[model samples]
Target chain A: MKRNKAVIAGIGQTEFSKNSGRSELQLSCEAIKLALDDAGLAPSDVDGFSTFTIDNNEDVDIIRSMGIETLRFSSRTPHGGGGSMATIAHGMAAVESGLCNTFVCLRAMNERSEARFGIAHMAPNSNNKGSGSGFLEWSMPFGAATPAAWTGIQAQRYMARYGLTNADFAPISVLQRKNAATNPLAWYYQKPITIEDHQSSRWIVEPVFRLLDCCQESDGGVALVITTEERARDLRQKPALIAHATQSIPFDTETVTNFYHKDLTVFDSGVQCAKEL
Target chain B: MTTNVKATIPANVPATMPRPQPLPGRDSAFFWDGAARGELMGQRCAACKLFRHPPRPMCPNCQSVEREEVRLSGRGTIHAFIHPVHPMIPMFDYPLTCVLVDLEEGIRIFSNLYECEKEDVRIGMPVEVFFVPTAGDKQVPVFRPARDAKAGSKGARS
Candidate 1:
């Protein structure tokens, strides 16, 4: 199979925190500017932008703020967290299609300090009427309102089938905290949670999850720059060559997915994506 | 092991916090409507005879546009559950034992055990469908201990 080549030229991110004390737009601009600087590219050199579809900041607003005059390519991916890694695929495609030379993928949000995604939103369909995809409505009314609750539904079934326990999942968080403790950029930097801490943590919903089971919602943003492999070699820094990326597959496992397979615990889409990648 | 003769929702639950209602859309209206009458309903792909939940328009197995409402046994076993300890959302009954039950009909539903404490619920615990009238003209299909749930009570470690 023939493929076009692209490379990640630079990466930039704001400090992780419960509060960034900055508007999302400002955070976005700051991250993007840092990425541009890291890539040794001027604002004028960036011609395209790609990000998650739910982003509040408009491309017009971003490019204008960056002083990039003529934007040629821009795109956004659906499904919020899935969009994080998915945009790199979009950027690669845009560059391969000759739509733009330099593509910037960015995301900025004040998840903890400003708005939150964990709130028990009214209905999955929402009273906002005709607002969302309505997938959430099925569980929302029953109190599986937050993202943790949403995923916990699946996690619950997985544990029950295998007879797994909290002790099984505690090591995952403990190891993550252990790693984060040494990383100065981490929210839990210099502070690690113990197995005891995980065991004693309060529940957000029961047997399979605890407060430590969840990642603390942090404020801030991150940005990345993508360009052609040929063009990337000429940039200021060593290019992180894009090995491969997967297409946007439907992330929803319950509805619109194949159930013929034996175990619902294993994600078929992920298996297929991994095999392909 | 400690066992409660009967499970119960905490007494102080706030009715003022309107329970989140099912947003029944065109694809799932039938399932929601059926639940209102105490029936656990799922969508059966007319072409494949496979059953599914949180109803959708077509069959993922056969790509068939045709589907039919399949009444379910409403009898299932606890597949997995979490005892949410924190009141991140004050609306939730603290220490809520949220569960995912794998129905005998080959689908999973997110619900809670109405009559048991967090300790009483267990993996593979048998439960039967029971309706909790949450909002006007809408009822949420919840689960409670089935008659045989006690047989599996030992499955619970705590």
Candidate 2:
């Protein structure tokens, strides 16, 4: 439907930390303030909200603090990690559909302090509202509890099919650490790891992942403001045009415990989603 | 206000330890029931003979709702497997080997693999299922290296 008609007018992020100490709502307000300032707009200009459902912060709560006059639309991407791009997709769709003039997409969390993904959640015992109630019900009883254990299934298959060794994944960690080390806002800023360090680090799951391969679980907020491309051009800075946005769920796809697929090695769904983007 | 319902717990589970029980009330009660009996079961499309694991109500192929139960051969190659070094959950031992066995029936199953060192495990390595009986007559499928994996080795496949 002639998509890409919307463009992101601003982006805002808070310093990443293992513990922000502040409440998630406070973090959400701070990021939203920065986003509005970056876009050369006030909170009053924000007419819609899009965010991570997994985020502890709520849009209405954030809006209450910002004193946003009205919200014409709001949404959250339901599935956790896989929904990042989809969050942007829904934001752009809001702009395209004329549902709202300014749509803000946000993801904020104190993952380590507030709710640790791998460490804290010992599910079925925790709650059933989480998507884990699906396939995880089968695996968790057997100790396949964390995301790494789940992804290890696919990662192992990928390494096997390609003859890739654990060392092969080290370069990726090294490169990311190098990049993060330079970004002052990153939790690992100015701290880089070597392949040696990555290799020696304890394994979270074997055959593919080590401690370094995993991302930092931190407390932070990141937000983007999207508006129609025509309106975006009049803003304070160059707009990041929504050239493309797409989400794909292929056959035999389960959110994370997607063990049943015939070809677990390749992210066929991700490849297709990227193609659409 | 404590009460008792021990039938939900597998027999072999230690009383002090909390075990992961499948969240029931789905279309696949038979699959778990079969696991309790040490058998592997899958759903077969009555129309196309296509097999599905963790049974579902509808057939993905041919859009047929009609289905029947079939017991699988429980033999497959190691499509991929992992050994978690840290063992996040207490139910498993550290250096745990979890496998995604690509069943000969063209379906896949997730389970633990045993009877081998971490280095000895390989993709495409042959394996067969065995049952680990748990509390209340429930059992979980686990794989071990196939005896005929090599020609004279017993793990051989055509």
Candidate 3:
């Protein structure tokens, strides 16, 4: 489908943190309200919503509390951080397909205070049965049980093949931190680290990564308002045009386990998405 | 011979009897076999003459099923590393290091470094393979310093 027709009219976010000090519904409303304000619109103008499946906030709850009228569309995307851009893509699709004229895509979570997703292992539970807990069952018994540990396999393989060092990965953290420092809304606002600091930081999964290299588990909500290019031009904020959007999955792919791929360093799905876009 | 003994052990401890699991699929069977033998194995494509890891059947370069299982030298230089402050699952309370190693055979392997201090690990340190066994008699290959290499040495630091 041709998808270059929609644009983001406004963007809003709540403070990122270990705790949000509010319910998921409240955080969602706050972000939606800010986004509507940024677009110079009211709650009554928003007719659609899109977010992540991991998100606890409900669209019905948001609509009821925010007094939003004429709810036409609402959906959710999966796949953790990979869903960030996918959420925007969904909003664009909704606008282009005439499912909703004015849509808001949001990602809000109390990832830190309530449930720290970074935790490596959860006790064997009913939800973890069958294929869901397969990888866990394989690695947990050997102490390679955390996300860092799982990802460390890829990192180690990449290093072994590329002659890369911890210093090479410093750039990723450095870039993110650099962007976060200037971002007033970021939890680590104005907090920048030096290469020396990264080197000196404590290790999390030896030889593969350190503490400073990881992204923070933030408790924040970010929302974006999308509309047709025509309406976007009439909106108050400068529209961030949606140039292109697509999602991809590679062959023999599993959630977080693509070990069979020839090159662990390069994510084929990401490469495919970039190429398709 | 060993299979017969293993088959009989289950009857003595029915509750603790381990199920006979199938071997990993074609793509990962080599890796699992290498781990069993305490060897780090990677795939080298005959078509393109390039080495790859997390072993797969077809060559990623040429999509050729004609490949060979080659044992890596197990010697590599640390390419990249990370220290995660917030503990990731399974391994908690201990500082973890994620090391990227450039294998001599032109493939990269990702694994943990053990039997060394976290502060002592440097970005470019030369390391060799070590194996840690897992359940079902599987061995997980890891790496560590090859010699008395200090963390701040010229070759060790980024």
Candidate 4:
């Protein structure tokens, strides 16, 4: 594949916290402003916008509040967390295709303070359409209401097929905390954990995941500025050139709750994305 | 190891707060209807003869809009199971176990497992489907250890 001349000019984020004490839109605006300032550009310079479909902050609201002079491109990627990085791909595509000269990509979530993903109950069928509803109709009636429950069932098959034990998962959590301990922006800054900590943590889903194995519910926002490599080189920051950016959703994969797929042990989408990259 | 944990909705939850019911849509009405009628249902691609669960309008294999409603054996092997321990919903009892059963028809279903000990649940264990009442007077499919399966036989670790 031919490489694009697009580059990431700047990145900015709000402080990671349990309660941001701000609306999701406000958090988004703050992060966008910070990202613009870091890139030595004004809101008016941004011609394209991209974000995850699940983001509560609307592009129109952001544009009206930020006083953007013109807009040429905008897109919303689906699949929640799986689409997080796809926002950058959308930006890169816009800039490289000359649809827009500069792009702003963002994700602002008040996940913890507002609706907690871990415990929030979604009514089955939820108006009887879209990706997860059909799967939920099958699973939720059986008491697997949460993402943990659904994912744990899939994870168990992989573990059992491979003859692995829960102890094998401890190192991942331990290493993640160890990295977070040194990063000032990390919520777990200076709080490194051990494999023992992971082992002793209470089970969220027995024999599949411990509490430590899961992500913390957080409230915050992050934004990135993308532009052509030539334009980025003229800006204040060093340009990080893009090599390859892509997203994939292979056949038989749902956004989540993928028990219907032929092989539970394999992540076909992730494999497809890796092969593409 | 069979503790015989009663396979029913948690007793403490008030009758007014029932479990969410399956709202069947055009593509999936037959499957839920089959559950209510105590029959396991799936769809087979009319062109390719491939079986699909949680029925959809078209088959991925042949892109065929034509499909045949098929009755499943309701007999399957437990391909995976989990016991969720935290963030408990009121409508369900604690120590609840959910399983992904690979049915004899080659399709998979997500359903609850009962009439077996939590410790005894294992991947590849043979199970047979049974209907259970959920909210809204609707019946959903669940599974129990197959009656003819020998006791004390461990599932393959590999």
Native contacts present in each candidate (fraction) = 0.66, 0.70, 0.25, 0.89
Q: Roughly what TM-score does model 2 have, to 2 decimal places?
A: 0.89
The best candidate in terms of TM-score: 4
For model 4, how does the per-residue alpha-carbon lDDT over B31-126 read when each residue is reduced to its tens digit? 888888988888999999999876888898889999999888888888889987777776665567889888888888888887777888878888
* lDDT leader: 4
Candidate order by TM-score, decreasing, is 4, 2, 1, 3
Tell me the lDDT of model 3 at A16: 84
Per-residue lDDT for B1-158 in model 2, tens only? 11112222222222344444555546778787777778888889999989987678889988898998888888898877887665455445444678887788888888877677777887778898877655444677778888666553434355
Model 1 residue runs over 4 Å out of place are A1-4, A123-133, A160-163, A178-185, A248-262, B1-16, B88-95, B148-158
- Best candidate according to DockQ: 4
Candidate 3 stretches with Cα past 4 Å from truth are A1-4, A126-137, B1-158
Q: TM-score: which is higher, 2 or 4? A: 4
In terms of TM-score, how similar is model 4 to the real structure?
0.92
Q: Model 3, B53-74: lDDT tens per residue?
A: 6556778668999887888778
Residues A103-161, candidate 1, lDDT per residue (tens digit)? 99999989888767666556334523222455566655666666677677667667767
- The superposed Cα distance between candidate 1 and the true structure at residue B157, in angstroms, equals 22
Scored against the native two-chain complex, candidate 3 gets a DockQ of 0.15
Tens-place lDDT digits, model 3, residues A1-277: 5553898998888988778898777788889899999998889999988887667788888889999986888887765567666888888888988888899998877878875656754454412432342444334433354567667766766786788777888878887888889988888899988888888888776666888877788888889999988787778988888887888867644455444455678878889998988
